[model samples]
Target: MRTDRIFGLAVVLGALAYIASAFQLQTSFLSDPVGSRTFPIIVGSVAAVCGLVMVVSPDPEPDWPHGRTWARLGIAVLVLVGYAYALRPWGFVLPTALAAGIISYQINPRPMAAALTGIGLSVGLYLLFKYALGLGLMALPRDFPG
Candidate 1:
């Protein structure tokens, strides 16, 4: 009934459930060669392995995060929520760039570099999804360029 063992077991169970749910994803005829299930399966497998290890090597004492860590985590959650909310109205490029830049700035206090990184990631991911992956992501809003 150790904490580490319980946590590990929970992780393992959660991973198994995730894998099971991922298997239910229906794929179209023109899906990728690896299919949609591949990534989830890989992620779940890794989680399961880690969980098993944690269960075997359970830690009696764990270091809990302090105030700063908690604050950062809270900020991150807020930023994510804001990003999701903004995505529809502002479109992919603007919201994504802003989120990335803000998060990067939170980690490292370099505003310019963070902004550039955000812009680069936004554009790069947009192009990649649109061209290479054949996925349609909203890059701009309908009433843009006004």
Candidate 2:
């Protein structure tokens, strides 16, 4: 029940889940030759290897919980869940910006800097995923004529 053991278990479980999900993915004639499952398989393998390494390694000293650590983690989880739920409704830009802002707030308490950083991250990610990766994530509300 040590932190290292817990982390190792988490990694193993994550890997297993990834692998299982990949196995469950259906394929079609239009699917890429490598298929969507390839990356997940690779990731799961890497995670399993890392988990094994962590399990074999000596445990590190555990740090006592800081007052804000749990709060920060909660904020991070909220941001991630919000992003998932808001992606289609709010589109890419606003939800991404909000998520980035929440993450930045945890990293730095300065409001102005966090806001700017979030804007930069949102724009940058939009360009990266939409242009470079050809993801075509909508940047605005669907009904807006813009």
Query: What clash pairs does model 1 have?
Result: none
Weakest ten-residue segment in model 2 by summed lDDT: 58-67
- TM-score, predicted candidate 2 vs. hidden true structure: 0.56
Q: Write the per-residue lDDT of candidate 2 for residues 35-145, one digit (tens) a residue.
A: 988988998999988987777783785876687898888889988987899999888888888889888988888899899988999999999999899997899898967
Instruction: Give the best candidate by lDDT.
Output: 1
For model 1, residues 28-140, the per-residue Cα lDDT tens digits are 89998899999999999999999999999987757768898788778888999999899898889999998998888778879899999999999999999999998878889
Local distance difference test, candidate 2: 0.87
Error of 1 at 97 (Å): 0.3
